[model samples]
Target: MRLRLLVALMGVGAALLCAMPAASYAQSCEMKLGAMGPMSGGAAQWGLAMKSAAELAAAEVNAQGGVKIDGKQCKVVVVPYDSKYTADGAAAGSNALAAEDIHLIIGPVGSPEATGIKPVAARNGQLAWNAAYAKNSLEPKFPLMFHIAPGPAVWADAVIKRAEKEFPMKSVALIAPNDQGGTDIVSVDAEAYKANGIKTSEEYYQRGTTDFAPIVTRILASNPDVVDTASSPPGDAGVIIKQLRLAGFKGPIGRLGGPGTAEILRVAGGLDVVKNFYWFETVPTEDPKVQEIDSLYKKLLGKDPVGGTAVWADLPAARMTLKAVSLAGTDNAKAVAAELRKMPVDDPNIGKGYWTGKKQFGIAQELSFPFGIGIIKDGKNLGVERQPARPD
Candidate 1:
C-alpha cells in the first residue's frame, strides 16, 4: 500500500511540471518597440501624439494575449524617447533605442527629425515611420523608413482650390521657421498657390522667436489678401496670428501644413480672434468612427490622448507595424519591412487608405489616407470636409 501511494504522488508531480512550461513561455516572451518624438518644446503636441499612438497600439495587442511571434505570444513594450524636434536629437534617439535591442520606432514627427532619423535608423537596422512634410520624408534609399502621411504635394492643390471657393484671394504671404522643416513645405505651398492663379510671397523667421511683431510688420507690408502660417508649429502660428490681428491685418489665415486647430484657437485667444481661416486637416475629424478613437484610448490606456487629431492620424502606422511583426514571425527590421510593403493599408478607425509615393519619393512607402479641408468663415467654424484618397 505504501509503494502504490508513493508512485501515484510521483505521477502527480510530473503533471505539475508539464504545466509549468506553458506558463513560463508566456511570461518570458516580450517585444520592445521604440517611440521617438519631441516630448517637449513648441511641437510637443505632435510628439506626444506619436507616443500616445504607440502606447494605444501596444495596449490593443496586449488585450488579445499579445502579438504572436515565432509560435509564441510576445507582449509589446513601448519605450519612448524625446527627440526635441531636431535632426541631431532624432539620430541620437535611434541609436539609444537600438542599444536596448528595439528594432521598430513609431515617431520623430517634424521635418528635421525625419531628415535626422533616416540614415541613423537604417544603419541600426531599425524601421521608423515619420510624419514630416520634408521633401525627403521618403526615399528609395531608405527602405526601412515610411511616411505617416503624404506631404503637401498630394493635397495642397485640392485644399487651395477649396479655400478659394469660400475666401477669394489674389495674393498671399506664407510664414514659417527658417529651417528645412519650414522651407520644404512652404516652397511646395507657394507652388500650389501659384498653380491656383494666386500671387505668393514667402517669409521665414528663426524658429524660437516669440515676438513675431517684426515679422508681422513685414508680412503686412506685402499687403497680401491672405496670410498663411505654412508648416509653423501650432504654438508659433498662434502667436503669429495674434500679432497679425493686433498689427491691423484683417485677412483670412491659412495653414497648409499640420493640424492643430484646437491648440491654435486656445493660444490665439479663440474663434473671434481667428476670424476667417482655412487649413488642411490630415483626417476627417468629424467622422463618428474617428471620434471613437478618444473613447478607445481612454478604455485601453485609462487616460485621454493628447495632440488631438494628430494622435488619430498617427495610430494606423503603429497598428500596422505590429501586424507586420506578427506576419514576419520575428522583430527583425528587414523581415518586418518586407511584410509591411506587402500588407494592405487599412485601419479600423481611420478606414481605408493607400500606399503611395512611388512617383514622388521613388518608393511606395508612404501611407495616403483620406484627408480633409477645414474652413472657418467669419469666426464661425464651418467644419472639415472629407476628400477622397488620390490614386497612387
Candidate 2:
C-alpha cells in the first residue's frame, strides 16, 4: 500500500510538473541530503517551493537509479528544515542538519540566511547550494558555497532597458523598505535608471509597516513617470499596487524581478491594477515545464501556488547539485564543490548560469542565470519587449 500510495503521489507530482519523472531508481541506495530554508514565515513560499524543487529533482535522480557514488547506487533522502528566515534560525537549522550527517544542503533563501548558515557548513565541511544577493557569499569566502541565483543587476538591467525603449521613463518614484535589502534594491535600480536616462526618487518604510497611504501619497506627490517598488515582499507589493491603483496613480508599475505574482493579484482582488507592470520574468507559466513544477508545488501546498511561485528559478540549482554529486562519486564537501563548478551553464530552471564572480567577491563561484524583461498581461508573462543581454 505504501508503494501504491507513493506511486500515486509520484504520478500527481509528475502531472503537476508536466514532465517525465527525473527522480527514479529501484530503491537501491539511501543518500541523505538536507533542504533548509524559510518554511513557516513571511518568506515561506520560497522555501516551500524550493522544497518541492529539491524533492522533485531528488525524486528524478532516485528514479534514475540514484546517484552512483561509492560503488553503489544511493537513493536520495532529503531532510528539509525551516530556517525561519532569520540568522539564528539558519544557524540552528544548519547545525541540526549537520548533526544528522547531512553534508549536502540546499537553501536558506536570501543573503542574510545564507550568510548565517555558511559558518556551520564550513565547520562541518558541508556543501551548500545557495541563492543569495550579497557579494561575500561568493568564492574564497566560502569555497563550498555556490550562488544559484542572479543578483539585482541581472534583473535591473533587463527590466529598465526594456522599459526605456517602450515606456520611456523620465522620472520614477519608489516605495522601499529601510534596510540593507532596501539598500541593495536602491543601488541596483539607481544604476539601471541612470543608464536609461530615468531620474529616481524614493520613500522609505520600515519593515512590518501596515500603512502605505502616507508613503504612497508622498510618492505620488513627486509626480514621477513610473512607480517602482524595489524589493517589496509579495504581500506588501500587492498592497502597494492596490493602494496606488485605487489612489489613482496610473503609470507603469515595475520592479527589478520576475512576475507571476498570483498572491499579489489575489490580494489586490485580481490583476486589474497591474495593467502595465514589468519584471524579470523568465518562465511563461503556460510552458509545460513551468506547469509541471507549478502543479507539483500547488499539490504540495494542497492549494494554489502563491505569487511568483511558478517562476522560482532555484529548482534547477537543486538538480544541479544532485547531478554534481552523482558525477563526483563522493559527497565530500570539497569534492562536490569542485564537481559543481565544473558543471556546464545550462538548465531549464533559471536558464543558463555561470561560475563567475571573482571581480565582485574575490572568487569565481557565482552561478549567474539568464533572464529577460517580461510584462504581465492578462495575468501571464507575455514575452519581452527586449531580451536580456549577456554580460561582459
Model 1 lDDT per residue over 19-39, tens place: 663324445599998998988
Deviation in angstroms for 18 in model 1?
15
- Which 10-residue span in candidate 2 carries the lowest summed lDDT? 383-392
TM-score of each: 0.93, 0.82
Q: Ten-residue segment with the worst summed lDDT in candidate 1?
A: 19-28
Model 2 RMSD, rounded to 1 decimal: 7.3
What lDDT would each prediction earn against the true structure?
Answer: 0.91, 0.69
Per-residue lDDT over 333-386 for candidate 2, one digit per residue giving the tens place of the 0 to 100 score: 788878887888677644555656766777666666555566665455465443
Clashing pairs in 1: none
> Alpha-carbon error at 358 in model 1, in Å?
0.2
